[model samples]
Target: MTAPSAAHKPVRKSRAVKTLGFRIAALLVISIVVVVGLATLAARLVFHKPVDPEAVAPVARQIHILITLAERDPQAAREAGADVRDEPARGRVDPKASRFLKDMLAYTGRATDATVIREPNSPVLVASVRLKEGNWLVLSALDFSPPNVWPGFVAWIVLIVAGSGAISVLAAIKVTRPLRIIEEAVESVGPNGELPHIREDVGGNEVRATARALNRLSVRLKAAIESRMRLVAAAGHDLRTPMTRMRLRAEFLPEEERGRWLSDLEELDQIADSAISLVREESVSGDAETVALAPLLESLVADIAAADLPVTLGRVEEVDVCVGPLALRRALTNLIVNAATHGGGASVTLDIIESQAVIRILDEGPGIPESLIDQIFEPFFRVDLARRKTIPGAGLGMLIAREIIERLAGTITIENRDPRGLRQTISFPIAGVADGLLSAQDVECT
Candidate 1:
């Protein structure tokens, strides 16, 4: 095999870096916002008090005006609703006014009362204390101006979280959307299909690199497919001359000899046909459609039966698959024909398993040799080369089946029945329209 060109191999890259960049950028933005919000909350709870005890106290101390005015006249103190006590004091000062003055003087002993004349509205500060006059003296002291700034602070927090969430969502879509597009484009290339081209216009550098890689792979793949097709065509053309001569010579031989020679020529023709089909199956360019796999299997069985083959189809119904209908039908026919030719008959079953349509064909003849089981999938490989003379099979059937199945994004696995024969299982994906028709008894492949 020739080494792939530079265009085919392209430069290798790790997608994790681009993915990590998007994640880190989005996370950093979100983290900063979260930190600021938390810091703001912490500062509010730690540094900003709910209600300042100092500010409230000064406001309560404005009652000092009435106390001082009541000190002047005895009748005036009583009439003005100032404290009137049942006690005597020096001078004509009202007894209640003298007591009130004494209490105010005692209350101001530890705290200040200097601004009374300079600022009457000066807020007061009062502490819990025992008063000799039986009433508490509450001093009010106030700052000329105090700041009230909390509502605006709270609004800032709400905005941060909402903004962070919105940014993260947009970032995730920016990253995931392009990746999904790449995925769909990759899926477009089946085992037989050509790879797609990478368009630089679709995304940034990372996406451009990916598209370039896909385009490179496409070129290499096209070359490989063309090579295989050429080989198949060459082989078919080369064998036709010998096959024609053998058929012509067989006409002049004894009846029994002619039968044997004719059968040999027929087998050669089958082999050539199988080679052509196998090459075609491998060089696909993703032309597939939804198909009802069960009905396809049933039809193959019916055809085999019409040809007088002893084939029994069990429960072939309602299993849909997405694939090339003609290619899948050919693959199934190859498998069924293989079983009929080698095992004399086949028991076929079709059903859905784990979102896949699975078709199984079992033969009651001696099972495949354990040693050759793996090699059986290789083109033109047979368990016993001598059996080719008697079996009338080209041995390319299973190989063709596998190639087609894989091209459809399915799989084919083989095993042996305990003491009897070979069991082959073909599984294909059910999706899109194929899945939608799952409820239908008979799905028509479009």
Candidate 2:
């Protein structure tokens, strides 16, 4: 068999792993950002120092005058361009001349930030220094640049964040591995698939609870199916005795009486037989041995032809599949009968399509209406609108066939041919097999 392709199958990502990864990475990033910002501020405070005080005294005095003037008659300060300042004269400076001098001398016995200036051509700098009077001496120094303390902090933060994110992703993989396994197993646990065993129990209480629930559900489903099958078997067995007695009694009547009674009895017999067959087919499991589909198709074709149905094997190929021999045979027989009866016999063809064994039986009879396709497989349903037919049947053949095919995880479909006919297609999973020749000497049942 060929491998499943992307078109036929889809790849799904693990939700648990993805969620965990994002959460861990985000937390680490936030932590790094906050810590890095605080550390940068701390480093700046630790390394900061004061510049020379002498050169700053005159500048400080000029700034103090400008503040005093601005606070009183603000327009006077603006008109005088009072914010401008220059270097002091080389001499023993008079501390009393500077208004801010007294405040500086009382603290470090010095002066600083001696001026404030508004120069249209130059950039401005603002500085603040503590004084003895519990006040501050403020000034603007334009010629110099402040310290750069942010680079080290930002670099460390980037390093920490990147490292944390990488570590978190790896850790999330380890943490969510168990949940991923459980998810995959849960996904596989359906009517057509088997659940796999979950290994590595990591996700706390929630994971354990989910696992427990799944186990309980599995057990409940098994019991329910078993109970249903048992009921069907018992019902089928009970119906056989009465039906057989009726058939025997109908045969003992007079010729005139027997004719009408026999027809009714025969129909009832067919109904009972179909019911029993349906129950048996539905109850069978998929533990049967594999069969070579080529010979099986050929044999079925021959048997159908022997029944005077114009059935012929068009093209047969060898494809082995996992199926119960009896059940598979019955399913094919039902399809053939359905085709022959309603579709006026058919040319059966079998071939493999994309790893699936497909059987197509084409007939020339009037095809079924599109609306009735779904109803055809239902038991007791008849496509014959007039309800006048020589062959008496309970309409359980297709139902039984459907059940048998489903038990083996196969499918059957019917479609209309171009020139007014029907085509029945049955597809089953193909197992590995080797091709062999068709010998004429082999048994042909027809």
Candidate 3:
């Protein structure tokens, strides 16, 4: 078999254990153990009161006298309360008491394998020593017992656990810092669809890298948008010269054909105007304030009805939204005109649902085809080709309306109404909320 080539060799992935998060997690766990150990050591040093060697010095002297007395007079030593035993000693051992007694006994020329054990049943210390004749000399006393230090040990444990918890929380926050930054940046998007500026120099390596990437994307998007607007505006300006010349030439056509020629020229003029209007909606930004929906809806209906067009105001709620008043009015006017022109008549209504101020415009005209519904927002998209000359639109109304609404930080959705009409809905984030109770306003169909 041929040796595997370097290109064919599986790439070695960096181990998860080597990641920053894993290291932080490992350090956090390791820190808990270290803290516990330190707390235990601190407790021992601060709270544990060991038996002082001096405190048991008398016990040592008593054991030495008992051993000497036992060597000569076993009965007198018994009278001195020295318990004599032939078996090995029992109970727990006291190292401090044992060490003190050993040094004292060795000084008096009585060095022996001795131990001091406390009785299992009482608060007592017992000193044990083996005599030269193989007998065990034992003495018990109450003065050598030590104080309880368990309470101090418990306190240290509590402090260690609390400190470990705090460290864990800090590690979690640090790990999620990038995510928090992303969420905050998205939430702070302004009414003009402008993203909040991100600082690249701050934060950890991962966070700084994310911020840099987002800032680059934002810069690229702004450049693309500006380029598109410039191209549209320049194209619109170039078309006006030709359109003016066409209009002048159409004025000289034969009397029978002059009307039709002028009508086509007028349609061309409207298209240029619509294109420029779309560009304005994309590039213009400033002077945003809360505009109420009720008065705006009423005024639009009145104007359209006065023009002898089929338009009506339906239930309008007194609600406000943050947006540029003129920009908002222009967007709504386009939608209302589109609905009234395409759908025989338009009925507009405004209501507040949840924290959103919703506007619904219903028209009785034949709705758009289901197959072409998604393309309705595309610029210059027309579903009914036969009506292109019959209707007076450049097919830019829906696109412009959508652009304006979205730039104002709102949403629009169009769906076919069940029986025979189209429903266009626009939603905006309500500002300076009114009580949930909608205002009572009766409006008749025009």
RMSD to the true structure for each prediction, in A, is 12.0, 12.0, 14.4
After superposition, the stretches of candidate 1 with alpha carbons farther than 4 Å from their true spots are 1-29, 35-127, 130-154, 175-178, 197-199, 202-209, 232-273, 284-310, 316-329, 339-345, 349-395, 405-446
Score candidate 3 by lDDT.
Answer: 0.75
lDDT by candidate, in order shown: 0.64, 0.63, 0.75
Residue 32 in candidate 2, Cα distance off native in Å: 13
Question: How many Å off is the CA of 236 in candidate 2?
Answer: 2.0
What is the C-alpha lDDT profile of model 1 across 141-230, one tens digit per residue? Answer: 233332445677668866876777677766665666556545545545545556545565767666677777767877988798788789
Off by over 4 Å in 3: 1-176, 183-193, 255-257, 434-446
Q: How big is the positional error of residue 401 in model 2, measured in Å on the Cα after superposition?
A: 2.1
Q: 111-191, model 3: which lDDT tens digit per residue? A: 887787877777666777889788888766454444556787678667766777678767866886776666555554433
Which candidate gets the maximum TM-score versus the true structure?
3
Candidate 2: stretches off by over 4 Å: 1-203, 251-257, 286-290, 385-390, 433-446
Candidate 2, residues 1-446, lDDT tens digits: the string is 22222122222566666787678767766776777777777767787664456666665455555555655664585577543222322233223333344444434434443422334544553443333333343454434334454686668777877887788677666666557655655544433233333322545665666666666665676677667767766776777787778768878988899888768766766776777776665543534566888898888888888988777788888888766777889889888887887777778888988878988888888887899877888778887745535665777888888877766657788888887998888987775431111011111111
Better of 1 and 2 by TM-score: 2
